[model samples]
Target: MTTIGILGAGQLGKMLAEAAAELGFKTHVFAPDADPVAAAAATHFTQADYEDIKALQKFAASVDVITLEFENVPVAPLKKLATPIYPSPAALEISQHRVREKTLANSLGIETAPFAAVRSPEELRRAMETVGVPGILKTCTLGYDGKGQWKVATPADAPPLPPGDYIYEGFVQFDKEISVIVARGTGGEIQCFEPVENMHRNHILHTTTAPANISAEIAAKAIHTATTLANALEVAGLLAVEMFITRDGHVLMNEMAPRPHNSGHWTLDGCNVSQFEQAIRAVTGMKLIAPKRTAEKVVMTNLIGDEVNHLESWKKPGAHIHMYGKKESRPGRKMGHVTILSPRD
Candidate 1:
């Protein structure tokens, strides 16, 4: 069995472990927190700070292959890992910061929101003037699930005269948000799933409906864009690209995650080979299966905070709810998610 070391212990990592097991792979999960959700099912696990080089080296020494759960894993440890890491350290380093991400996107002839690097109040002011108000301020590093970012719809909402560094991005006045999830085998075979329309609540993903209602031409563009990006990044594992579609039908690059995305979670029961399984195949150097959605329309809803505690009410036939086994429920925390696959009207 090919041994794999996963470099994060979030729900993504947890599900990846499950997929790896089915393929006869032993997974070693490493995270900073003790007894993470992934640790529950992973064959082996290590709890260590992400920056702990010694711990990372030890963790990497044991596995034959390494992959990451999220893009936030620090680049240093990934570079130090003994085994080759998929999705490429190059991909992680570029995708980690918004400034770098947009730079790369722009370099590839992809359109991104107008943005500028803000390391001081002056830079922020100039960026505001250059990019205009009704913008977003995001920390260049360590942001996810809407954390580490803020929107300034008006000048009053502006972040205080900034000593702290940030990336200022122009707000996109778009009609909808959509995402494409793709898995690229190490041998370079690429398989893509249908694009999904995403709805957000307070910057947290509320729901994702697959086969997103869009023109066939637009959908084709989205898929082609995703495939091009995955290949361009030399991505060797699962990757998801978030995008914004203007009312006029222009597609703008939003950002990306180097693992199975929240928007793709509906695939758990809605597809022949879920994103989890595809990720496993990619990282294990196995061939990827052609994606086949179980339903013409699939919807996934996240269970946040106390909503998970009352899941008994959501317990109904046809509703597949997954709980992360988190001991406590806090506001905005992703306690679990539910996937529902159905035919389109």
Candidate 2:
């Protein structure tokens, strides 16, 4: 059996391991953590610091192909591996930095919120002139799940600048937020799952409804934009494009994650081919399969913080529960999710 090496053993990696197993592929999960959630799902778990080049070399020698569950994994170490990595280090590098990501999107003619890179107080002040107040200040790297972000409602509201590069984005009045999961094969073929409308609570994803209550035209446009981005990046794996639909009916690109996304979790129970399976196929050079919704409508709700305590309450017919097997459940941490399927109207 072919062995697949996965980087970052989080919930995403756990799901990826399960999918790889279902497809008869052995998964080797590598991370610095002593015990990761994905270890249970993987055939082998390599616990070593990412900086340990010798450990990475041994891990690479054991796997046929390598892919990452998260983009924050150090690209330098992976570059030295003889094993092939899907999605390319270049694509991962671009996704890791917000400035590079936004610049790439804008250059591709994809509409995005006005943004400026600020490295110091003076640069931030200058950026304010163009982005104005009521903008978001985010670190150029390593920000996710509402972390490393500050809202600037007014000039005085701006927090003391941290010692690093940042990106300032003008706030947009959007009608709804949606995400498109586009999968690209090694042969350059692309397939997109239906767009899903997302709702966030306290800057963290709360719920997602597939086949978003959107006009066919808007959905088509969103899918097209996501596919175009995946192709432009020359990505050989799944790309999740989060977009904002304005009240004026225009779709603006928000962010891109070059892997399985929280928004696509609904596909696990609602689609014939789940995002996890697609990721495995993409990285292994298999033909990309278009995901077909098995249900008329599907709703996925995240179990965050103490929400996991009420897991039993969400257990009902047509509801699928997925727990990440995490021991500690702290505030704002994702514990698991529940997906419910509904008949089409």
Q: What is the C-alpha lDDT of each candidate?
A: 0.86, 0.91
Q: After superposition, which runs of candidate 2 have C-alpha atoms over 4 Å from their true positions?
A: none
Global lDDT of model 2: 0.91
Model 2, 1-345: lDDT tens digits are 399999889999999999999999999999999899999999999999888999999999999988888888888988998888888888999988999988998898888889999898788778888887789888999999878888887656668865897998998889999999999987888889999999999999999999899999999989988988898889988999999999888889988989999999999999999999999999898887878999889999999999999878997889999999999999999999999999667
lDDT of 1: 0.86
lDDT (C-alpha) at residue 149 in model 1: 82
Q: Write the per-residue lDDT of candidate 1 for residues 156-264, one digit (tens) a residue.
A: 5765654655898998999989999989988889999889999999889999998798999889888877887888888999889999999998888889878888998
Q: Kindly report which residue pairs in candidate 2 clash with one another.
A: none
